[model samples]
Target chain A: MEKYKRNERIGAIIKVLGDNPSKVITYNYFSELFSAAKSSISEDILVVKKTIETLKMGRIETIAGAAGGVRYIPIMDDMERKDFINSLCNKLRDKNRIISGGYIYYTDIIYSPELVDKIGKIIAGKYIFKEIDYVVTMETKGIPIALMTARYLNRPLIIVRRDSKVTDGAIVSINYMSGTSSKISTMSLSKRSISNGSKVIIVDDFMKGGGTALGIIDLLKEFDTKVEGITVLIASKTPEDKLVKDYDPLMVLQHLDAQKEIVDIVPYEHKDYV
Target chain B: MEKYKRNERIGAIIKVLGDNPSKVITYNYFSELFSAAKSSISEDILVVKKTIETLKMGRIETIAGAAGGVRYIPIMDDMERKDFINSLCNKLRDKNRIISGGYIYYTDIIYSPELVDKIGKIIAGKYIFKEIDYVVTMETKGIPIALMTARYLNRPLIIVRRDSKVTDGAIVSINYMSGTSSKISTMSLSKRSISNGSKVIIVDDFMKGGGTALGIIDLLKEFDTKVEGITVLIASKTPEDKLVKDYDPLMVLQHLDAQKEIVDIVPYEHKDYV
Candidate 1:
């Protein structure tokens, strides 16, 4: 096989490393693939690493030892992150987004690949250092962001269903009261979705009373799994008494009056990151 | 700003172009961002373009005009795509995946980011040249894959819900028969999800008799939209007659016997691609 040029090798490395975020790739693998020497591969990696860092796209962590290699961790610098969240807040603050029944028409943002990818990276960056076996979310709107987060973290995404379906086989269903409506609702998960003692991070598009998150927590308990963290794109400001206490919300819906077509949103102030 | 090295500029260019697939980006933006001349940026892009093409990762198209720039289109060679599908089929062939009601427990694959991303790329590649306004799918199992497809295609994802929620505002609901059970079911979509005369592509995780896809087609009619294409990860072979006539299915599940745990699966032979 012909040896790949420096530019070719660098592009291939970025594609591989970027595709498998947080997963280490040994230099030997690249050297063999490119028919290049280890030192040359190392030089190529340095260029990729520096460029990534300079652009604030992500970080490349190098492990030194017999079983060592480099891994990509997607991240956004504080300025970019703050800018992204502020822009998201501004978009959410649009008066036209106020639909009937006090809800915002933000499905476009939720499902947009570019926006969801950024949100996933931001949320996944927070828990990069933490040990999370899986990223979990309920059915419908949350799946896109959760899937992207799982992709970045190199973990499986487990979605909790609103109702148990025949396709799920044996499922563990739980009844919980909706924090927003105070109405009882049932959530179910297939028995094979998560293993016992697994650690999971829950993500969702919007949070009102944290009832759905609470329901997920209860469902996870049924599997003997633990909820490591809960994150959402937006959480309402009206519900001060949240069922799930520990959580991370990117933006807070300060106020929304459908009748007046007024909406106020602010980025959540993270004590540590801020 | 210090002028970025060729290698550094190449890496950053790949990230930016790769991140926004199919979206044209002007050289002026890159030239200004890197404090370099337009000619220098063009040289940098050439190298990145050749490298990507050599690796068969994707193609970089440079349109020459006032509205023209560079756009990245992700693709996988026939061998890689076949290998991916074969591996997916092998995983699905596992006897343990057989659930009680002749259903396959493959939610893991549906929610898997890596697999789903690849599937999305393959499906999106098929329709890259086609003008599609939105990538549509039903709620639950299909959202993750559909979301990725929408992301790669750079289009909005429209999800049809099993039932209309109050948050959806005004909705258009339609009843359809389940191919497997022959039971009537209702599917709804927000009125604002798709506009009149929009062209949509329907995607799903599994198809029994194409009933769900047909339902989506019927639902799209309410908005005067058209179903340009329908793609699914897997489709059952038992019911040879399908509700939807034209569709692309990755794999044909020939047989699945829960009692014997016997299964027969094969990749769908595309008339053109094959």
Candidate 2:
């Protein structure tokens, strides 16, 4: 006997899938929960999928096999994505965001849960099929978005530390030159943070010099981890050429005039980073 | 005409609510989307609330009046909360997690998106009705969970920096001694991060001497913000008398015999910390 009506089961199913995006939900799991046959659960998923698609929320994909299950892939459709990016660009373009040294302050935006959750989902949507093992980022501004991306991708997050700490156990420290400057700085990663030969995508809040991204890429090499892709919430327009050639940025910061109190930032065209 | 059927609307409604916990969504929003009357949306919410309650997933609370709407509150229940805390304690008990300085190496656990998400929800559940304006934490390990807490609470997060940076645009710096040691370290925050006389909760990954939490409390005082409560993922049992008397912890670290390879940790009883 079924414990819940179709609508109740559908509601609960959506809650579970929404709670855990990118993580597969087995039919048997739902079947046991509802005390219904797998066929009934599959039929209910069809309704849920149609409703979500009609609403343009995202996509619900089902895998067919013994290891297969349904997963929620957060693909903000084109119009919605464009609107979101445009709104974000507007938020970043605030005149008050320009600091004295010509640095654009968007620490609050990237630190926002709703905002960063969307940013993470968009980043995760790019590499849904890339078979990523971990979402990698350098501390500390990038941790929130990177963690959100890891959540959407259902992957672990490996945070590279600026300095080696005793709590990290065995650490690997490496020095890399700042892309836009002559100064060199060090970045360290815990040896056990990632499995060797794992695939990782680097994420950050901003890419001015690209020095930090380059440093992270070099540090990841120690673990024999493959750099699948690199992404940033925003990248500077100056230094048109970055130390790293291929990185996807959600927005491009074109101009920041501390004197005029002007800040010009725009959303970048969405492209798969991995 | 209604755009979606009853079950479909219920499914999508749950998805929307689950995606945004503690955020108010008006019936008008759903009515416009589904082209259904407010009465219909109200009835759908009834089903959602019943299903969620029956399954012990959480609660769907409805507010009655202008500027009011329905919101989801994540309540893990006593049994589930116990199970979760117990599982975490078991994970922390691994002897291999001990470092040279007796520092437990649970950074991986705290950095895990899934684990930290649950931890954040559990923490946020405690302060759901506390009228918190913001969630505050000192970077960098506490950020993931803090951001998660802020997400669940629908509030902004204020991250204290170890050192003041030009990007911060008028930073406030303070030196606080380490809880376990007499070593003093400087922590900074942007002057504009919080408004004067705001209410906040301090969150961190670990607390030994409560010096860091105290430092954050003191730092927040600079902004004239109220520290309603403080929470940490783990606290040492040795410091039965911590500098801060009223803070809460998810787990208590009883003892760690590095030489004997034994780790004693346990779940804390649930209590209203605020």
Candidate 3:
């Protein structure tokens, strides 16, 4: 518990603000929650705010009114969103990067901030109409994108890990086939990570067969929550029926020939961003 | 050209610094490059430096000596790294986000400042060993990651679009089977985008079939450059014949069961980060 005390506190404050975004909390509320003084609570709030602002994740709007406390809203607009995505794309195209079997080695790009930002905005823009509450993606690289999107939308990004970790409490698991892997894989989400009636967006970098995507769709149904939409960075006409056929692709992988040495790619139009 | 004249100027300055980390550039050089005044050049550097610093992308080390100018270096430690990722992760986990199909809708996250910081740090961390002159990724989601990583690494995040846009000049393309689409796809990098002998890293969200990964690798090889490494968030067990075999995974999809009544799931180990 101590390992995550700071994180837990931030989560709690976020939750309180998230629950009633319009309703601000006084220092006294956080003070009582952590058994700390009012000043300490204010300091913690500063940390939270600093973290939010530094990450471009969200904003902690403060009101000095007698009844005002704090409100957190995650939002971003077009120019900033495009700039962030442009940054990530640049990293993935570096010349020094290696490639072997036919993938552009972009493990570094997945962890990069620019990619996370663009992914966040793309997903947020897609679901802006849904009045969404939680953002979800399968773990690892999707985590950053999910987190960034949640920050932009002023919501939360929940990660469905492939397996339960020691840190996650009371894990809920599911079995789903990965169309790309052509194998059944386990996916897990924390019991407390999501709530009922939550609107979610599913995102990933690439989608081939989409068994994992479909599996994720099925998982949300288990939570009694709604899936607002499905989005992928790249999509193609793979041999298998795509699990994410219903979703839109930001970019399309039209054709590629590893043996003959030919590959065709198409970028998503800018119309969506503008 | 006009659309990105200013951006390209800033990008050029970043590239210059990236190529020569130990050297400084006089305001006169930038002024001449942009056909602006010395004061304007200084102002632009200030803006660029501030932007990079705010994102923690990198630092613009200034020298006051008569011959002194500005230089950049890619540097960050574990705590900064951890804090960056945690903030992004927290933002994406907002409860108000809605979920469906197991994906976290995060188009906005890609554009958010929060993600820019986290992703910048993540990619920079991976290239710590490499004398990276640039960060690269394909278009769309990968752009932001490339940009931010470039900022942190004090380099330019060069982009390789699927196809050439009107603004781009001549391009060299490669063909490889896309892991996601399983078809011949075109992969291209602008002739002006990157320089030879640059160190680079590759990144993406998921490694399913890794066809796109391979296509990118092929494109890089066309330039006869060195790829520092590849990193990904999720490495789905798509089959061992992937284009990228030696790489790091933030998380792995360890288990799945498509036929089960209620699926059972588990997440990958946190050892990668630890």
The RMSD (Cα, Å) of candidate 3 is: 14.2
lDDT of 1 by residue, A1-274 (tens): 4478787788778878887888899999988888889999889999989888887888988888888888989887899999999999999889988887788888889878889999998889888988999999998889888988898898999999989998888999999999878799899999988889999999999899889999999889988898888999999987899888998899999899988889999999876541
- Candidate 3 structure quality by residue, lDDT tens digits, B1-274: 1222343355446544543433567877777656766665676576567655544445677888788888765555456665655554455445333233333333355544455445555656666546766666765455555555564565556667676543244568887786655678777876656777677787665566777677777888877778877766446654656766776654444433333322221233333331
Worst 10 residues of 1 chain A by lDDT: A1-10
lDDT of each: 0.88, 0.88, 0.59
Candidates 2 and 3: which is better by lDDT? 2
TM-score of chain B of each: 0.97, 0.97, 0.61
Tell me the docking grade of candidate 3.
Answer: incorrect
For model 1, what is the alpha-carbon lDDT of residue A139? 84
For B62-105, candidate 2 gives per-residue lDDT tens digits of: 99999878888877676777888899999989998988888789
Global Cα RMSD, each model: 1.6, 1.5, 14.2
Model 1 chain B is weakest, by summed lDDT over 10 consecutive residues, at B265-274
Candidate 2, residues A16-63, lDDT tens digits: the string is 888888889999889999999999999999998998889988889998
Model 1 over residues B86-197: C-alpha lDDT tens digits? 9999999999999887788899898888889899998888888889999999988999889889988999899999998887888999999887678999999988788899
TM-score list, all predictions: 0.97, 0.98, 0.45
